[model samples]
Target: MEHPIPSRILVFGGTGYIGKYLVQASVSMAHPTLVYARPSSPLTPPANLKLRDRFRSIGVTIIEGTLEEHEKLVSTMKVVDVVISALPYPKVLDQLKIIDAIVVAGNIKRFVPSDFGCEEDRISALPPFEAVLEKKRKVRRAVEEAGIPFTYISGNCCGAYFVNLLLHPHEKSRDDVVVYGTGEAKAVFNHEEDVAQSTIRAAVDPRARNRLVVCRPLKNAISQLDLLSLWEKKTGRSFEKRFLPDEELVRLSNTLPDPENIPVSILHAIFVRGGTVGFELGKDDIEASEFYPDLKFATVDDILEVFLRPGAPEPYRGNFK
Candidate 1:
């Protein structure tokens, strides 16, 4: 049964990497979308200014504030039916404030936290990455304790983003790619747009409430070698593959500086350890593609074709650089 009124969505960190896509998806879904983002200043990047302009032009309500502002968060929570946090890794714990506000407001129907990467509860990653996951786990425990209607999204690897990192599609002169492990470990790589759209759909879904929804389409699953093969076929070029074994990834994860080590550790887990594909989803977990059959998600080939186009922009590097 379809509801007559659309859910009002308030997105925290909506101007960040995946957050922007979430905001776009929310608005595209005809939700009365509101974004709680940092106030813009002359110091803000031109690209970000352009994004803010685009948001305003499209009728998205932008509430400029910080997560620290308790009153503002509570008031905002009062207005929206769904609250989704796309706060990056560093700000994972800050959602506790959002939780506090939700409790005070007592009006939110659902809360989607910033667990958009791996299923933290499942895999055992390198120490650096495991530390990050621990922080997310803390948020999960808090949300469950608060009894907030929530959906934990395990989006796996973002398609174009990881593809750009692995293939260097923007660098025409580059002729080699790094393959983690033997390049035999398969992982899911869902397009960011699909993840965003499915997230929005799941945020309001009755079945998705209080469950973990994984964005793992069978067609999107492929090994590093398979991905390379597809890219080589698309560009009509064969590049040399340099294999980075598990020991080297372990060394980098251990030796690299604080946050610099974090990405390497994550790469170790996903590429070398097969962290994304190691476990089967529990019975309560929802595989997004199967749950929403009508939503057509892009495959790895489709993403490669997008890169082959002239003047295609480089995917957002995020912290993977």
Candidate 2:
């Protein structure tokens, strides 16, 4: 049962962190790629303009419009065979409008919504994270009810991004690392590039239609202690370990002062309560690495080696460090 590759692929949020990689993956796979971008606003930053130019130079088709413009979205969608949404957390619920546009367009073969963090259907997160998941779930329900052939990608935590967050790898000056909970609960951390590649692959595969494709590489499935110890070994330096007990995480989640800082609550769910530890390899899960055996995966050790190398670039220094 070979699934035919999509000739024209459309990506929403194609300039985002993961979206940019998806755009490149689609192009590299020789799919005629289209990116849905909003028309440039007066306040649009120069960096964004440069990103658009970069995409254009590589021959990506740009459809400039808003999700509010239903007719425009439908007209644009009508030309593509598959649609992949990489809309970020804040805009996740906006996918329902895109699903509506897909229904109106009536030619979309497969739709991949933005379930790239965790399996939104299963985990019970704290208020902040749960609200984000709930919006995604709403989009899922709408996709199902609209009868859109869909593929839900459960990519777990992205290693390049989340690892920096968890271990503060960019902060070379730091003498201590915060160990969430007992630092014993294991979680999968797929690199962002792998997530994008697997996502684009699933979007075109008939076997992936109406299925949940989870990206859980065995080597990348690690705990905070595993990451901390690995970093220490790589750097040949020992640092103080500060443990954030599960009880403290719960207390902060319940009493955080600012709602925007609610990521504290989400981290509590992931590290303390083991929220993102959804699938075990070869046991009731569709592991992407196993499903596509040819692609090499990045493990936590690999990540630590790169980020801890001499003169390594501080990618997330400003915000994460």
Which candidate leads the pack in TM-score? 1
Q: Evaluate residue 286 in candidate 2 and report its C-alpha lDDT on the 0 to 100 scale.
A: 65
| lDDT assessment of candidate 2 | 0.81
Q: Model 2, 1-321: lDDT tens per residue? A: 233464699999898777888999888888999999889888777877788899999999888898899999999988999999988777878898999899999999999997787788878877776777788899999999999999999888877777777777667798898888899998888877788888888888877788888887777878888877888888888879899898887778777665554677667777877776753433444678878766677777776676766764344421111
| Residue runs of model 1 more than 4 Å from their true location after superposition | 1-4, 319-321
Q: Cα lDDT for residue 262, model 1?
A: 91
TM-score of model 1 (CA atoms): 0.97
Question: Model 1 over residues 205-291: C-alpha lDDT tens digits?
Answer: 887989999999989889999999988888899999999999999999889989899988888899888988889999999999898
Worst 10 residues of 2 by lDDT: 312-321
Error of 2 at 12 (Å): 1.1
For candidate 1, the 10 contiguous residues with the lowest summed lDDT are 312-321
